[model samples]
Target: MSDRFELFLTCPKGLEGLLIEEAVGLGLEEAREHTSAVRGMADMETAYRLCLWSRLANRVLLVLKRFPMKDAEDLYHGVLDIEWAEHMVSDGSLAVEFSGHGSGIDNTHFGALKVKDAIVDKLRTPTGERPSIDKINPDLRIHLRLDRGEAILSLDLSGHSLHQRGYRLQQGAAPLKENLAAAILIRAGWPRIAAEGGALSDPMCGVGTFLVEGAMIAADMAPNLNRELWGFTTWLGHVPALWKKLHTEATERAAIGMNKPPLWIRGYEADPRLIQPARNNIERAGLSHWIKVYQGEVGTFEPRPDQNQKGLVICNPPYGERLGDEASLLYLYQNLGERLRQACMGWEAAVFTGAPDLGKRMGIRSHKQYSFWNGALPCKLLLIKVNPDQFVTGERRTPEQRQAEREQAAYDQAPAEPQERQYNKNGNPIKPAPAPVVEQARLSEGGQMFANRLQKNLKLLGKWAKREGVDCYRVYDADMPEYSMAIDLYHDWVHVQEYVAPKSIDPEKASARMFDALAAIPQALNIDKSRVVVKRRERQSGTKQYERQSAQGKFTEVSEGGVKLLVNLTDYLDTGLFLDHRPMRMRIQKEAAGKRFLNLYCYTATASVHAAKGGARSTTSVDLSKTYLDWARRNFSLNGFSDKNRLEQGDVMAWLEASRDEFDMIFIDPPTFSNSKRMEGIFDVQRDHVQLLDLAMARLAPGGVLYFSNNFRKFVLEDNLSERYAVEEISDKTIDPDFARNAKIHRAWKITAR
Candidate 1:
C-alpha cells in the first residue's frame, strides 16, 4: 500500500470542468478533466477528504492497477495478480462493476463475473471460505473499466454515490440529483451570494433539493457528513484515525458556521403533495433553522424578506418532451418572468430549462448563460439580473425614451442608501408594497389577425351553440390558410390540433404561426391558458395513432344530446366524444327504439350509450382496446344503463365473424389503417372493407339497417356492394353544422338486404 495514489472522480456529464476545479481545491493534485470524470493524484487523507467534501462528484475511485488486456484470460489474470487479502477478508462480501467493452469482452456482466471469479479464487481459504457476492452493503466494491485495449481496476472509495447525501429518502417524480443541483448552484454563483450573506429562494422547488443544497453551501456543511455507510467503512485499509481527523474538522467547521445567524432561505412548491416531503428533507439535512418550505404556486409566489434584501430567484420548471407541450410551457415560463419582474425587481434570477426556445419567451433578457446536461438532455442556465434595464417591453420606445432609460439604467447600477424600515401598530414590520400589476401579454400582428378570425367564428357559432344547447363544437377548422389548425371548445376547455405543415412551407415560419395561434387562444377565447391542450395532428400509421399523448388519467364529463360522456382532454389525442358525430348519434337515438343495436370498432361507446338512452332492447359494443372498453363501462355507468348493454374487448373482425346474434341496427366505423398486434393481420379499410362488411352483414337481421362510416378522405365505396345490398349515401345527413365547413370530415352510408 502506498501513501499516494491516482484518483478518478466521476460526475454527471457537463460537470467535469466544475468537478476538476472543486477536486483541485480539495487537495487533489494535477487534476485533469475528462468527459464525465477527473483523473488526479491524491494521498490517502486527500482521497478521504475528496469523498467527504466533493459535491460535484458521483464516485471517488482509487486506481489499484492498470494492465494491458487482449482477452478474458488476461482480464482474469490481471485481477488475480492484485492482493485481494489487502483490501477485504477472504470470507467478506464484495461487488464487482465492469464498464466499457473491448478486447473480446463485449458484455459488461460477463466481464464483471470474470473479475469476481479471479478475486474469489485468489481469496479462497483451504476450507472453501471464499468471499461471497453482495450487490448491496458489500464490504468491498471493485470497479473495472476497459478503455481502448487497457483495463483500469480501481477500489471504490465512495459508497453508492456522493449524491445520495442521506437527506432525500423521498423525492419528487423528477428530482434533480444532489451533485447536479450543487453544480447548478455553483454555476449560478450561489457560493459568492452566500458568502455575502444574501437570501435564496426557489419558486418551483420539488422536495427542496435546491434549498437543502443551497443551505449546506451557505452553512459550510459537508454534503455527505451525515452518511453512515461508505465503501471503505469495512475495508482492510480503513485508516479510522485519518478519516476521523478530517471528519472532525468538517464537523467543527459546520458547528462554527451554524452558530452564525441563519440565512433567509425559502422554497415554494405548487404541488401540495411535495410540501411535507420537502420540509422533512430539510430537517434531515440539519437545515430546518435555515430553510423553510411552503405550499405556493408560481403565479402567487412572493418571497417576503426584509425590504432591502435581494438574492437569487432560482427554479427548474418542467421542459415538456412532446411537441404540443411547448404551447403550455411557454405561458409557464412567461408567468415565471412576470413574477420576477413584478415582485423581485432588484433580485437576480437563474432559470434552468431544457427548452431554450421557451426560455426566450420569458420576456426578460438574461445577461449570462451557461450550458449544462441534466442527465442526457442538454439544458441552459439563464442568469438574469432583474431590473428595469432587463425588462422587455412589447411596445417600441422612442429614441428619446430609450436614451433616458439607458441613463437611468446606468444610475440604477450604482448603490443607494438603504430605505428606512416601516412598522405596523402590532410592532411587526409592514409588508412590502404590492407587486406591480403586470399587463396582459400583447399578441403579435399575426396573432391579432388570428384572434380576430376566432372572435368572428365565435360570434357566429356562439349563437348557434347556445340555440341548440351544444356544449362542445368545432370553433375553427383551418379557416385561414396561414393558421392551419382545428380548434374545438369542450365546455370551457379548448383543444387545439395543429395540422402538420407541408414540407413546401418553411418549418420556422410554420412554427412561428403556431406559436402566434397558441398565444392568441386564451385571450380570444376569454379562458385561462392552463385550460388549453394542444397536440400536433399528423398522418399516423399503425400503432402510433393509437398511442396516448399523455398519462394524466383525469377525465372531464361533457354533455351531448342530453347524455353524459367522459372526455379526457389531456390524456389522448382524441377527446372521447367526437363533436362531428353528434348528428349521427342523435339519428341513432331517434331510430333505436325497441331495436337490438350493435356498434363495431366502438371507441368509448358513445353511440351505444345514445342507443341505450333511445330505449334500445339491448346494445353490444366491441373494440380491441380494454382501455376504451373500461371507459365505455364508465359511460354506461354514468348514464345508469349498465344492464343489458354488453362491452366486449377483442378484434372486431374476429368477434364479428363468430357472432350468431342478429341485430335490428348496426354501426361500423373502422379505422383508416390498423395493424394492432392483437389482431392476426393488418386491416386497411379500403382494401378489406368488403370482408368487414360481409362479416358484419351476416349478423344483421332481415329488414335491418346498417350504417358504415370512415374518415379516409380518398375512400370510395365499391359498386359491387350496392349490387349485393341496397345502399344509400347518408353522409350529408350524418354531418352536423359544426362540420359543414369540411364535409369531407367523414363519409357514411346506410345498407339493407336487397
Candidate 2:
C-alpha cells in the first residue's frame, strides 16, 4: 500500500461502502474502506476515473508525500520538499486548504498561509515568477492535513465536491444531496429491482432526486455525464489521452444503456408547483424517456395495475420542527403506512425522514433503520418489507401513540368560548365509556339522485381526465339542483360545496338533506370521511369568500392539465384551483412557450403556472390580495419561476395602467364584482370590461392574443368593442364535458387587434 501512491476518497458518513464498490468496479483493488472515507492505491488514470464515475464520493485526493512534523518551521520545510513545478507553472494561481490541527499549526488559515509561502519561496527563483493566490476557481488546489505531529500533503484532484452534478437548475423547498439520494436508492436495493425488471416510485418525490438517481443506477450510466467541470481538468498532472479513453467508454456505455429498458420509474409530488421542476430535472439528467413525475399525494398512492411489477416505494416526507406541532404530518405518515400495506403488497418500502418518532406514525413495522447524515440533520432510512402480515387492517395503538393523538386532537379542537372541561380534583383526567357509534343515515330519495349523478359524471370525466392528462376536475356542478351542491375532486380528496338552500325550505329539513349529501358523498365515492371536506357557499363577493372558515390551515397539491396547483380544501371556500378554467389553462399552455405572459386578476396564479410550463420566458401575475399573492408565490416557486418582479400585490387595473411593458400573451379572468377595502375602488367585471380590455390590449404586443373570461351569466359584450378589436366567443370550447351540463359556467373570448 505504501509503495504506490495512495489516494483518499472522502464520502458522506453512510456511503463508504458505495464508494468502495465504485472504486472496485473501476479496478481499484487496493481500496481500504472506513466510516467516512476510502483509502486506495490509484494512479492518475484511476483517480480521474473515480472523479468521473463515483456517485458517492465527495472528494478524491492523491497523496503526494507524508512526513513527521514538530513545529511551523518543520511544516514549512516539509511542504517545500515536494516538487511543485511538476503540477503547475509558477505563474499559475493556486489555493491551499488545510485541515486538522497540531504541531503549532492549530489555525487552518495560518497553516495554509505557511504552506503557500514555502511553495512560493521554493518556486520563485527557479521559474523567475510567483503564483498568485486565487481562492475562487484556483488552477492548482493543495491540501495538507496534520494530525498530532504528522503531515500528509495531497493534491485535490476533485476541485469541489462531486455532488454538484450540474443538471439541477432549479430545486424544491428541501432538496436531497445527489450523493445521499444515490446512496439511499442503493441501500433500498434499486439495482436488484431494476435487474429483475421491477419499477420504482416516490410518493413524496420533490424535484425527482431519488427518481433520477434510481434511473441512473438502473441504467448503469455515469452520474457525471451531465457535468462538464472536472477538478482534474485543470491539474497539470492530468493525462488527456487516458481521460479521453475513459470518457469514450462512458459515452459508449451511456448510449447502449439509455435505450435498454423495461424502465418503469415514477415520482409523485403533492406540491403542484414542483411537478414541472421535477420533470425539468429529469429532462436535465437526460432520463426523460425513463422517469415520469406527476402531481399526486401519498394518500392516493398505488402501484399501477398495468405495470404489474413488484418494486420499491421510497420517500422523504416532511419532518416539521417540533413533535407536538407536527400533528397533521402524523396523519400523513399514518396514511402512508396504511396505503403501503393495502396497495403496495409484495413491494419494499423505504422512508427517509429526519424524525424517527414521527416516522413511527406510518403505522408499518420497519425491519431495519439505517442512520444517515443529511447535512446537519441526522436522518434515518427506515426499510420494511411490504406484506399483509407486516401491517393489518385494525392495528392497535400503543398508550404513547394514543396520548400523542389525544394531545393533538385537543389542540385541533380548542373551544371558541374557552370553557374548561371536567377533570378530577387531583388533576388526573377522568374517562367515561365511549358512546355507541351511530350508523350514518342512507341517502334520501333526493340525495340518491345526487349520488347517482355523481357516479355517472365521475365515470364520464374520469375517462376524459385520463385521456387529457388532467388530474383535478369537476364531477358534479349542482347536477341535482335540489341538493344544491358542487362536488369537485382534487386527486383523491372530494370537496363538496353546498350552496346555502332557500329559507322557504324548512330549516331542519334543509340541515337533514345537507347531512344526507355529506353522508352519501363518502359512501358513494368509496373513500374515508377524512378525505371529504364540506363547505357552505353563501352569496358573497370580495374578501368574504376569501375569509377563513376554520383554523385548521392545510393545503393539498393537485394537478390540472399537466400543471400543478396548490389547493386548500379545508382553509377557505375556494380550494385555490378554479376547475372551470381547466380548459383555458390548457389553451394558455399551448401558446405560452417562449413568450412573455401577463395574467391579470391572477388568483393563485394558476394561469401563470400553465404559461411557465408552456416555456414562457417570463410571467407577471397581478392580484390585490396579499394572501392570494403569497399563494401565487408558492406556485411560482414550485414551477421554478420565482422572480420577485413577476408576482405583484396590487389592483390589476392600476398595475395594467402603470405598466407600459408589452406582453406576447395576456389572460384576464377577473371576478364578477369585488368591493375589497384594499383596492382603490370597486371592480365589476361587466362594468370594467371595456376599460380592462383597452388597458390590457394596449400592453399587448403586435399580433398578440388576449384571453378574456368572466362568470356574469346575464351580461353581454359591448358591440362597440368590435370596432377596435376582433373578438370571438369561445365559451363552448372553454367548457369541458364535465361542466357542459351547467352551461352558464363562464364565458370566454379570444380578442385580438383588428
Candidate 3:
C-alpha cells in the first residue's frame, strides 16, 4: 500500500527540473518543481530512497504535522499541540530551523526559539523531561517554512545537509559546494547528455567538482552512497525494514551499473596547487579511473587523442572577482576562444562567467546565454558551437599570419642604430675599447652602498621589537618606491628580501635601481651587519634534496650580536618565518610552560624557540625537509634550547603515525604548498589538512589543546569532526600590528576535546 506524504526537496535555483527527475526516479509520482526548491508526494520507503539517491536535492523534508495560524501566539499554540511526545523522546535533543519568505515572523532565529519553546513545553508537560537543543547535530530536526502568512512544519529527514556527501575529505579555496556543482551540471543538461554518451570538460576546474558531478550523473551512482547517516534514520515514524529494502534495491541497481565506464570527463588547470586537489577530489568521488585531471596552462592546452572527438567543453573560469584584474581575465578569455577555435573543432563550448565585459572578449557569437545566480551574483552561461569543416576552412587569418603582420609593423617603425656599426673590419663590426674595470667595480660598489643604507634602516627598527612590546616589526614596505624591499625583523632573527612589483616603465632599470638601493642598508646600520641577507624570490621547481640541503646550509652562520642564526639570502619570497605571525608565536611561548609541544608544519622553527623559551619541557617539530630541521635546531640553540627538543624531518602524517609521544600543546601551521623531494608526497594545506588534523589529534594528550592555523581564505571545517572536538576561531587574536587589516592572510583555531 502506498502511504501518502508531503515531501519538500530543496535545490539551488535553475536545477528544479533535475530534482523533479530525481524524485520521479525514486518512485515519487507527479513531482512538482519550484524556483529553488521542489515538492512531491511519495510513500515513506520512496522518500528514504530519495534521501539516499537524489544528487540535486539539498534536503528532504517530511511533513509531520500541519496546523493553521493567525499570529505568533496562535503559531506557538499550534506547534505545542502537535503531539510532540509521539515523535520526540523526552530526553532526546532537537534543533529548530526556519525559513521565512513573508509574514510577521521575519527573524528566523526568533521563530526558531519560539518553536523550540513550544516543543519543549509540550514534552515537559507530559513527561517532565524536555529535550535539549544541539545546534551542531541534533537527533530530531524540526523544519518550519513561513511563506505568504502560512506556516508549514516538517521533519528534516536529512539530519545534516545533503551536501555532506562524505567523499570530500579535502577542500580548496572558493570550492564549489558539491550540491551546487551537481545542480550546475543538471542545469547544463548533463543528464540528457549522459544518456547520449556526450562528454564533459572544464578548462578551469579548480578542484574537479564539476567533473566529479558529471561523472556521477553518467554512472547513475546514488549521491549518498558513501554517506554514513541520514536524518530519516533517526525520525520517529521511520520503518527500519522498509528503509533497508529501499537502500538495498538502490545498491543492487548501482552494482549492476558499475560496470559501465563513465563518460569522457576531463579537467585542466594552470595552477599546480590545484592539481593535487583535483586528483584527490576525483579519487574521493570514486571516479579516478574514469576522469582525467591534467596540470597545464589553459592557454596552451592541446586536445588528447580521445578529446579530439569534439565533445562539450564547460568552463567556470575566474570572473575577476575571486581572481585578479579584469584586463588579464579578458586576455585569458581571448586565448580560451582561440584554443577552442584551433583545437576543439566540431565541439560545443559553454562558459559560466559573472563578468560580462570580460565575456565579450571571447569574440565568438554565443548561440545562447542563460542567466543564473551563483550565490548572490548573477552569472551568464554562454553556449557556442564550432563546425569542424567551417573551423578548418574558414576565412580567418592563421596564427603565423598574425605574428608576421605584427613583426613587419614593428620592423618598419624601428629606429636606426649609430653609424659606428658601419665602420666594420674583416666583415665584422669594429670592436669597442674595453671600459676601465675599476670604473665597473666602482659602479657595483655604489650598488652595494645603497643596499647597505636600507639594511641599516632595517636594523634601527629591530631595536624597537622588544621596546614596543611587539613580537615583530616591519622595517620596509615592498610597495614603496624607495624602500620597495620588505624587511621583517623577528624577535630571534631578521628576514630581508626583494619584492615583485606590478608592471612599470623601464622595468629592468627599475629592478636594478631597486637592487642598488636595497644593498646599501646593512653597512649603514652597522648592527649585526652579517645577519642582513638578500633573498631573491622566484617560482619553485620540482623538489630536489641537494637544493633543499644547500638552501638550509647556506644560512648557517653566527651573527655579531651573539645570536646563532641561519640566514637564507637566496630564493623564497620571505625567509621561513612570516614576522606578521609574531604575536601568535609569543602567545604560544607564554603558554608553553612545563608542557610537551608538537609543532606541525614547523617551518624554520621560529615559533618552536618561543615555546622553548616559555619553559616547555620537551618539544617535537615535524616538517618535510632535513634542511629546515637543521635550521630549526640552530634557531633553538640561539634561544638556549638543548638537545632535549627533537626535530623530525619527514611527512607530518607519517611522523604523527610513528610517534608514541603525547603533546600537551600542539601547533599545526602548514604551508599552502611544499613540493619537497625528501617527503613521500607534496603537502597542500587545503587538500591533506583533515587527515593531518586527525593524525595530530591522535597523538595529543587527553585534555590537550591544538592550535591549528592556515592561510587558505575559504577553509570549511568538516561537519562530523565538530561533534568530537570543540573549535573556536582565533584569527582575530592571531593578528599582529604589522598585518592588522588583511584578515585573509591567516586563520587560527583553538581545538579541544569535547
Candidate 4:
C-alpha cells in the first residue's frame, strides 16, 4: 500500500482527451491519454478522489499484475501466482470480465471460465471453500485483459461504470450515456459560458441527461456525490478513514452548489412520457429549483422574448440509421435549422448528430464541425452562430412573387376553344394520340418506405438464394408492421398476402398505405403489374382455406428444383406450392433415393414429387381434399411421374390405420388445425400430434424414418416419444434462405424406429 500504483481511467471513445484534462486538473501525475482510455499514477487518496469527483470517467481500474502468457496453461499459472486471499475471502462471491484473444484463448466465455476455475482451485485447497460466481450484484469485480501474449489484471475500483450517476430511473429510446453527455457539454464550452451567467438549453433532451449534467457542471457539484457503493467497500484492504474524508468533502461541495443555481436552464421534448422522467432526474440531482423541462415541439421553440439571452443551445437529434430512417427524418433536421436561425439571433447553437448528410439538409451552413464518437457510431457536432447575417432562415416566398403566382394560376385555369384534329389525307375525324400513362402516381411516402424495406431485404435474401439455387423465395415479410403483408416471388411472378391490420390503425391510413404498397411493389421488383396477384391471408376454419375466392380456375406451372408443379393464384387461398418448404423437399430428394416414401396430409404432393424424382422405389400421397389430389396428379404427370406415384383421396389417419403397408421413409406435415366435413373428426396438431406420430410409427418398417413437420408456432412434441425412438429436431436445417429471418416459419423433426 505504500507504493504509487498505476490507475487506468476508461471513458467513451473520443472523450479520452477530455478525461486526460480532467485527471490533470485532479492533481494526478504522469497523466497520459489513449483511445477511449487514460492512465496516470496516483496514491490511494487521489484514486478515491477520482471515484468520488470525476464526471468523465467510466471506470477507475487499479493495476494488480502483468505477466507474459504463452498458452492457457500460462494463463492459469499466472492468475494462480497472485494471492487472491489479500483481496477477497474464499466464501465471497465475485465476477471476472475477460477481453482480448491469444495463447489458445479464442472464446471470451471459455477464458472467463478458466480464470474462475483457477481462482476456485487455488482458494479451495487451503480453506476448503470456493467463491461462487455472481454475474449480477457481485461482491467483487475483476477485470482481465489478454493482449498479444501478455495479460493485465486489474481490480475495478468503481464497481459499475461511473456514468450511471444514480439518478436515471427510466430513459427514452436511445438515451445518451451520462458521462458522454457531460464530455460533450465540456467540449462545447458550457462551463465557461455558465461562469459568465449564460443560459443553457437542450431542445431535444430525453430523460434530462444533458440538462442535469449541465447544471452539475455550472454549480460546481461532484458527479458521484449520491453514489452509495464502491468497489473498495467490501475489499479486505481497509483504509476507511481516508475514503470517508474524501466523500465528506464531496458531499459538502454538492450541498453548497445546490443553493446557488437559479440560472435560466431548461429542456424541451415532444413525448409526454419523457417529461416526468426529465423532471424526476432533475429532482434527484437536487437541481429542480434551477432547471425546468416542458413538453413542446422543436418547431415552436424560441428563447424568452422578454429576456435578452446570450447562451449555449445544444441538441442531440436522432441520427437515422435504418433503411427508411433518413426519409422520415429529413424534415426534423430542417426544422431544427430553421428554429435556430429565426429565433435565437444572437446565441450559439450546437447540434450532435450521427448522420452528417442529414445535417446538411438543415439548410444552414455550419461554421465549425467537430468529430466525436457516440458509442461505435461516428458523429459530428456542428457549431453555429445564431445570427441572421451568418445563417438565414430562408423563409417563405416574397409577397410580389406570391401575387404573380396567383395571377398565372387564374390564367391557366380559364377554358380554351376546342382545336380541330388533323388527319393524314383521308379527312376522317382523328383523335389526339393516346396520352402516355404516368408511372402510377409515384408511391406515397409511406409506400416508398415499405418499398425501400422490401428492396433492402431482397438484396440480402436474393444473394443467399442465388448461392443456394433457390428460385421461389419470399421477397418481403411483415417488415413494416403498419403494412402487415407478405410478398413472395415465384420465377417472374409475385404473390402478395395482406395480414389483417389491428383495429387501432385508422382504416383510411391503412387502406392508403396498402394501395401505395401495391402500386410500389411492381416498381421495386422490376415486374409488370399484371404479374402480381394480391390476396388477404388470415386464420381460416374448416373449408375456408379450400373456398375459392375466384372462379377463374387460373393455373400456372412453376418449376422448383427442376420439378414442375401447378400453382393457382386466383382459385384458392394459398398457392399450390408452399415455397418455405423447398428445403424440406430437397431433403426428401437427397435422402429418398432407393427408399419407399409416404407423404401424409400431402397438399399438391410436392414432397412426393421430390421423392419420386430422386429415384424412390415407390411413393404414396394421402390427403382428404379431392381437389388437391387431382392437382397432385397433374403435378405428377407434368414431371413425367405416373405409375409408381399413387395419389389416394382419403383421410391420412384412416389410411395409416387401415393400410398395412410399411414404408422406409415417410414425411408428415399436418395443418395446425382442421375440422373438415370429409374428415372423421377435428385434428389439432398440438393436441393430436402424439396420436398422429403413433399411427405413422406403427406403419413404419424396422429402422425406418418418419419426418414430422408443422407450422404450428406453439407445437410441442411428446417427450416420452424420445424414449421409444431416436428423435432429433432438424428445424434449423429445414428453413430455406427466404424464411431464415422468420425461424418459427415452420418446424421439422426426424424420428427413427429403434
lDDT of each: 0.86, 0.80, 0.69, 0.81
Candidate 3's residue-wise lDDT over 1-754, tens digit each? Answer: 2278989998777667767887898788768887788887888877888888888788999887666666788779879878887686888889899888445676889888888999998888444777989977787999998877778898999888887787676666666678877766766676777788777878777788888878877887788887766675666777999877877876776666567865677887654557887898788877887889875445555654464455678878777544343433555676677778777777777788788666667666677777776777777887777554233224356789678668756754555454323221112233344422321223256566565555654455544443444434565555346445666554334566565554664678767766665444443443354555665444333332115323342443322112233445444445555655666787787899878888887877777767766767667888777656766755653443432356777888788888788889999887667676557777776777788888888888998899988776677666666877898888899875455535566888899888
Compute the lDDT for candidate 4: 0.81
The candidate that wins on lDDT is: 1
Task: Estimate, for each residue in 216-260, the C-alpha lDDT of model 1 and write its tens digit.
Answer: 999899998988899999989889999999999999999998999
lDDT tens digits by residue: candidate 4, 284-388? 888899889986556557755345877988989877532123433555677677777767767888888898888887767778888888888999988877775
- Better candidate by TM-score, 1 or 2: 2
If the candidates were sorted by their TM-score against the true structure, best first, what order would they fall in? 2, 1, 4, 3
128-220: candidate 2 lDDT, tens digit per residue: 789999887788888888866889898888887888787777887778889999899888888898888888988888899999989888887
Question: RMSD per prediction, one decimal?
Answer: 17.4, 12.5, 19.4, 21.9
Q: Quick one: RMSD of model 1?
A: 17.4
**Which portions of model 4 show Cα errors greater than 4 Å?**
125-127, 321-324, 392-754
Clash-forming residue pairs, model 1 = none
Report the number of backbone clashes for model 1: 0
State TM-scores per candidate.
0.57, 0.60, 0.52, 0.53
* Cα displacement (Å) at residue 506, model 1: 49
